[model samples]
Target: MAGSNKDIKVAVIGAGALGLVTLKNLLEEGFDATGFERKSYVGGLWKYTLDETTSVLPSTVANISKQRGCYTDFPYPDDTPSLCASSYIDDYLQSYADHFQLRPRIRLNTAIRAIKRDDANNKWHIEVAPTASASDADTETITFDKLILATGTNDKPSVPKIEGMDTFKGQVLHSQTFKKPEDFKDKSVLVVGIGSTAGDSAVALMGHARKIYLAHRHGAYILPRLHNGRSIDHGLTYNLMTVQKLMQRFAPNVATNMFTKFAQKIQDTAFPSIHEHPEWRLSPAPSLRQTFPTVSDELIPGLESGDIVSVPGLKRVTGPNSVQLDAPKEGDEPMKLDDIDVILFCTGYVNDLGMSLLEPRVHPARNTNPAWLALPGSRGKPLARLYRNVFSLDYPDSLAFMGAAAFATPAFQLYDIASMAVAQVWGVEAHNTSTLPPKAEMERHVDEQHAWILEYARTGPVYPQLTKQFEWLAWADEAAGTNVGANLGWGAQGWTFYLRNRRLYKLLTSGVYTPHLYRIFPSEKRKAWPGAREAIERMNQQLEDELKTKKV
Candidate 1:
């Protein structure tokens, strides 16, 4: 993955965590990079808002632990709790921005409204605007050697176009706009979507609302965030190479016993309709994609207590304050919910990347089903056709995205690597394999990634197997100089760093693939960003003064 540096001038859209890391890294690597944020701040989706751009719910917490959620270079403050709140996420991002001096390169209240290409030089012409709001400002046309669309999938609400949606007399909202469960007080609410937001809404709204209907087509696995008081995400480190060895050489039942013990500690919880009749889980497909064992802990408890009502996928909007619900059994007659007050579609985002920005010749995410594949008209949504989930298949290094996949893994960890790959793909950074492949080769990779993402979306919790995500990160680590995926080493104190990860190191070396004893490879010397040491030193001094980090 090597290429010649073109002294590329890059414009990154949406300065969230992904944008911050990317702009910071690109600047350090000596690229003429500038970041444009539609909002007045640096944090993107992580920064919760009441406007149309909001992505996070007020009650949101990282489904994964703080250890798993953080960037490679910066650690969360020790005071930060496990399974940290999104507010802390906001803080962590701000801290990263401050550490890297990213603000200077970032233009707040700026947006890339549209994009065009300079066919002659293989560059991108980006249309710029001052605000994401209705107040029209003088639009400017600017050009860049490359563009990174880090505007995440979560911002845009993927509301399904129901027949007679406007006819509903009651309020209709997307989970993106939901702030508190208390808002739906005494009203019967149908919370749509099946991811963490839906789970949080259903569980929180229970007992508060007159009745809570957890709507879904395909049922998802309702998982607990904390198992026996420890974050289950952090517990994944138990995947030891020695454990793999035992499963292979001496005892096959070892794996079974391990799984049972883990499962015994966990419980199977689903919407009551699906839980009571396991067969109905098949009706709403793409339902299982949102259900991981650790996605939402409160969903099951809420269901069991009769606090949340369960309904099949929404079939049709029959009238104002009325809708037809699909039955648990596919061919069964649709049931009618005549008294519905608020319909909160918990459905996930559609990442229709740069429809206005990208020319027709270039491909964006082909599957743009922003409704998270729940509706019939998902043809135009933003499930992307990205290469290795980073670069665009049609445009290669010149056009790319960060944090594209709707993954269950720690996001910033993934986004950080994708950030590095942008530089790697552009041949702007020196690494062992820094060459950008030919267009055909890049397209082939995109096709391969497209298939993998589709499969992951289709197959449920099995995708949460951390090793596969590690393999993906390893691909990013190859591009970035950080060998985190290579062996999981970052700056930490002594055995404090490697003790917990010794088994992870062994597991990385294990040859067995199952059941995810996935493959990993040694990386060549991770080339540092030009003058990275000095940059880090400055960051450390600033953080020491700001964060007051203790010196061991």
Candidate 2:
């Protein structure tokens, strides 16, 4: 059946982590696929350099462990640390490419210029140009039967223009340009925004910078990287996905209270000095269920020790060397900071969805369909009309966006599963074995999901792409005709698995839910990797061994 896709030519844009996995899945399903990357390397932003490319800081470490970070089929070596460094992640991605023989199919230094839909012939016309460092290849146009946009969400950095910023004598930069700790050595730096980057930058500057001021608009639940000497993800978060879903569904308020209470308890236990020093004003969000968390081992400690100061939202720039902050409450007086050398805005990035590359009408905002327009709060949002956050309602058969949505789970595994779903839908559509829902039905489903998202947003922060891992797995599995949930003891088929295989069932439910388990079962759409079971067992053993030694 894989041979049936030889005639289908697929073009994948952006060769980052998601793009690499997208290309791998397209090729695995036997599509004649080619990947385009603007950079010379395959790791995208993970391939760090001082150049304009957005990358991690020199001291950056993965927020999650390698077990969740790596691809399913390929597990990290036993020697790898539980928390991988940026360099390790970069090397691991390169290893993934080499192991799968994907480099030959990739065109490094080739950048996509424009993509036009040929409605008459049902093909995509893509224009590409080689970068300056690459060979002097002339710009060329290529045709493909399908297009996948893996360009990623972090393309356009969100930098706000503060009033009197021009008068500021010191340097003002976005976190995208932050390189190393030495850049701000012995200087007073004001790090804006309270996300992971803000926490990281503040903590990384701890002994280097003379003073660090962390400013934020709202409160955040700062979680520790380690709890009781074990990685928090492996010891606490990974095993609670099912419980999280159950509480969210049946008792929403109760779940919110319990989670927030537990998070506060952890914060209090980890950083006891914060409670004693009320003037520091590290007010946490009432419900962490709404906003993303800031994870760091030293951020709170730095703040508690008076090395870093926490302040309210930035109000305005007062002078070249000073800035005013908002009152913490309605009655309190506003605060001001002076002698600041650098103001690093850790404000995040907006997703770039083929804005300039594709025709204007192809964008979600320009959709004229009544059904799409009828969806509440769907207008003007680029990714709102997507069904399952992959297929386009207008051109479901020809277009899909990989790594479009943001999830707390591992990025690589999510993109791989989503890519497989795309491959399966396109692979079978040609021969009449299609499992794709009809166009109108897809529009209705998209509208319903949009409504649900709008309702969920009313409770907390506006995280449009924040999705649950199991829920995404359920949708992706149904689209690909896979029984991953059933095989892994989730949903209705979980009962059958529980009755049939008790040993595996116990491991699947109680043990770590590693990425490899997704590929452990057979599927008609995609072949099961024989090594998946071995990978799962190896990961379990590694975790057990680490726990025995307390190296976690």
Candidate 3:
């Protein structure tokens, strides 16, 4: 439906980081956009407040990379550090919302129930439910020309069904329910899983909990936030996109090996032999050699001082107050702890799109495994075939899923790219609707792209290489009718490349052209066309030469 300004009415699901950014970008582009947040507040997972069940203690919040996470047009405050807490992020989003007058369009405490396409009118019928705790509730239906699912996967915590979990007398909760470290003060606590949150939560609860047992079924690479007096996270955040590209082009194995070694070191120093855990499955993301959370100066001394202890996975919970562990060292008999006040299941969240409005489009066959297709669905029909991770093949002028990948760069950056693509789609269709590609052709293209990514991931890192971001953007921009090569120096890559390339100071913000443009364009174009197979083979050879010389 058209709005007062002849703008397209768009419904953005999820008001967290991804949603907030998507909504803001849409509004900025003169689109009549409204946001629906399941939670009462903003900031999605980043929002932190006191809860009676869990006490607040000194702990590091989700550290948003101001350089990478903030909008390109808006710079983060200079005073802000590389890592800021959830409160800081919440405040930042609020300020952005206020600055752009985006609050009025957002409907807080509103949850989306279903989204159905009206084939007759070529519109999307969205069903939204209020967040009020009522069993028999009426849902409000709204129609919009476009729908954006910014509902991030991280927002939902995945709780695995473990044997004898419910019988435990001690409180068991997901990391989402965890408020602070003080709640486990002087009590024995067992933390399950070993993702970013698990690492951060374990470190935070070190001193507070009398005995902290970190249960990991398998080994994960532990990266420190800082290395050589510089934030490794900064390197990862700022240069990750480029580094990923370099790795993809030159030394795929070297790139994977570098991160594997780094994770091994962290395992050796902090929790030796942890990688040998029977349940440890290698991560799909490219390994960061020294990428660990930035432990606050105050917390490091305590960790070394023996306040926190990392253990293997949880074997079983014998009783309400007692638990057993699959200890790291052999001959270290089955360890048991008592009087456990709280058990923080740092186990990760499941990305179930069918649970949300993306269900109707999901086919039963694909529903069994959503991650397999990189599309959101459970079992039935496919929602939309992904085109280079952005546009959908089946729907004309429709692009809902981006930043839906299980683990990659933060969802915020992906949302930015998606918004830009959406705007482009709107702009392109407004001019000539006939230029759009056929759905069948687009589907084949997407299937090929997915196959390529899957093969690439198998030979390389577990997660999409950082370089894939640039690659995807280039392809997406082209598909959206924008000149990615020309926009690189003007968009996110412009600032990013400027920071890393010392020779391009004059061209940094001048919008001046660089010679790399010529080299990059041909390489990207070759990768996009039927000649990509030969291009990739040639690129692999070049990468080997570069890696042998660099010896990284």
lDDT of each: 0.63, 0.76, 0.55
Give the TM-scores of the predictions, in the order they appear: 0.77, 0.90, 0.72
| Model 2 agreement with the true structure over 376-426: per-residue lDDT tens digits | 332223444677778878788888887666666778878887888888888
- lDDT tens digits by residue: candidate 3, 1-552: 343324578888877767777787677556778888766776665556564212123455544355445653444555666566666666787777787777788888776776788868878887777744433356788998877777665555566556677669988888777876777778777778666677677777865788766666554454455444433443352234456567856996787677567545654455443344332333333334212232333233333555655556677777878777776556868766666667788755454332355544532124322454343111121223455444555564654654454334445555665565565556422332223467777667666655554554333223221125556655545543333344344577656655666453333223211111221232221222243223323333443454477664
* Ten residues in sequence with the least summed lDDT for candidate 3: 511-520
| Candidate 2: segments with Cα more than 4 A from true spot | 1-3, 132-137, 236-240, 278-280, 366-383, 429-434, 456-460, 489-496
TM-score of 2: 0.90
Assess the local accuracy of residue 416 in candidate 3 as a C-alpha lDDT between 0 and 100. Answer: 61
Query: Whose lDDT is higher: candidate 2's or candidate 3's?
Result: 2
| lDDT, residue 386, candidate 2 | 79
Instruction: Please state the error at residue 272 of candidate 1 in Å.
Output: 13
**Per-residue lDDT of 117 in model 3:** 81
